[model samples]
Target: MTQDLYRLIYLSRNTIPGSNENIHQEIEQILAVSRQRNAASQITGALMFNRECFAQVLEGAHDDIQATFERIQCDPRHADVVVLDFKPVEARRFSHWSMGYIGYDTLASKEFTQIQQATGFDAKQFSGERIYDLLHAHLYAAEKAGSGLGKIA
Candidate 1:
């Protein structure tokens, strides 16, 4: 039987109540763990941290994605977790990545400028589909260059 695939996208505010350094360190740790866990579970997606908030897309088997999101919801590092979209998908959008990532440094780039215009520069203003589009752009770019995520310029 073909494995069923699902996609879930969410937005959450960075509520790591502490110093900026602590928050950065925590995010790094989360990325490291997510990469390992996602790869092992055959999940793929992208995470975008725009200094103040996070937008993440997860694609995998239904149970895997659901369990992953549940774990994310329980994390105290972020709050107000909002599920933007969750539905069955025909294919994985970020197949080459376990958990690709992008951060604030790409904010000034022209390619990102276009994405911002399309998805709204402010995370709060983005729709679920718009966020997915932005993440897909970074994912495809990373794959084409044979590089990992977080390298988008």
Candidate 2:
């Protein structure tokens, strides 16, 4: 039988206090480590951060998703970690990416501004499906445009 597939979406406030360059470097480190670990675990996901908060969607086996999320909750760099959704999925939306990253630079200033205005970096203001849709749309646009802005795979 095929193993069950699941998707977990979450939001967290970023607690990585530093200058812009330092923050970027820290995020890079996170992506690097996440890419390796997620790939090893056969997990696929997308991560979006705007220095103030983080929104991510992880997909894999139920146990794997749980373990990964547990680690995320324990991570010191993230505060007020909240799981928006967790349920069985029919298929992966981010199959090509072990841990695709979408930073502030990946989106246009106007679009980013609109998002900031709407959510104000508040986790409570967004839903899991909203976060997933935003990430998926942006990733799709980036790929279509050949921007390579957030393609970590």
Candidate 3:
């Protein structure tokens, strides 16, 4: 029998109370743990951070994504968590990664110029099919350049 696969995308402002250095460190810590846990849960996704806010996509079994998202919403590090999209999908978008990541600084990179020019590279404005398309394009460019963002696997 085929299992149901679900994908969830959310955007939230980073609300960690600390210095910039501390915030960066905190995010790194979150990534480390998230990678391990997501891998075990068979979840695949990418996280985009811009110091001010975050946008992440999670894909996996419906129950797994649902449980993971609930915990994410309760995490103090994230605030104003607005889910941009949630639905069953035919396949994983970031199949090779447990949790790939990209920082806002990449907005200035040549590879990201297309997305930047189109939407001003605004994280909050990203939603639904737009987020999926942008991420696929972004990851394709990153993989081709051997630089900015990559898979955890």
Candidate 4:
């Protein structure tokens, strides 16, 4: 109801049992609607996945953020939505973005194995903790790099 900034977040374990047959398509649809959602409200976020779980951070106005979460809650792709983190933010880290996208491209997908080897954690370790760490690090890294503020901030 208020115009304050909010970050909509949750973690969910996978439910489709390792089937890409529908995951990509489902993500595509989400992204499509996400653009429309972005038009209505400021939203920037990332989706992180290990072999089994998903963790995400979405920052935006309260109502639009909650509306998106409601849609994701009913999404058949993942289940057991737990609000791992949620709160208002004074300044959003992703203030420059509207609806950033990340999915199973070769590079983004390889983060799983690379994080395992680099962090010395197995794919399913730490409740997908390693993935979450790398997700924040790498996504922000990529955003910073692509933001074209190189050599001098």
Best by lDDT: 2
| Positional deviation of residue 34's Cα in model 2 after best superposition, in angstroms | 0.4
User: What are the Cα lDDT values of the candidates?
Assistant: 0.78, 0.81, 0.76, 0.61
C-alpha TM-scores of all predictions: 0.81, 0.87, 0.82, 0.64
lDDT for each residue of candidate 1 in 38-99, tens digit (9 for 90 to 100): 98888888888766778889999999999999999999888888888999988887887788
The alpha-carbon RMSD values of the candidates against the true structure, listed in the order shown, are 4.2, 2.5, 3.6, 6.2
Tens-digit lDDT string for candidate 4 (52-150): 656677777788788878888998878877775567877676554454554555355477546545646433343333444555566667776774211
lDDT (Cα) of model 3: 0.76
**Stretches > 4 Å off in candidate 3:** 108-126, 147-152
Worst 10 residues of 3 by lDDT: 108-117
Supply every candidate's count of residue pairs whose N, Cα or C atoms clash at under 3 angstroms: 0, 0, 0, 0
- Residue pairs with clashing backbones, model 4: none
Top candidate on TM-score is: 2
| Model 4, residue 130: C-alpha shift (Å) | 9.3
Q: Candidate 2's residue-wise lDDT over 15-53, tens digit each?
A: 998899988899999988888899889898998887677
What's model 4's overall lDDT?
0.61
Point out the worst 10-residue segment of candidate 4 by lDDT. 144-153
Model 4 segments beyond 4 Å from truth? 1-3, 17-21, 102-134, 144-153
The CA lDDT at 137 in model 3 is 70
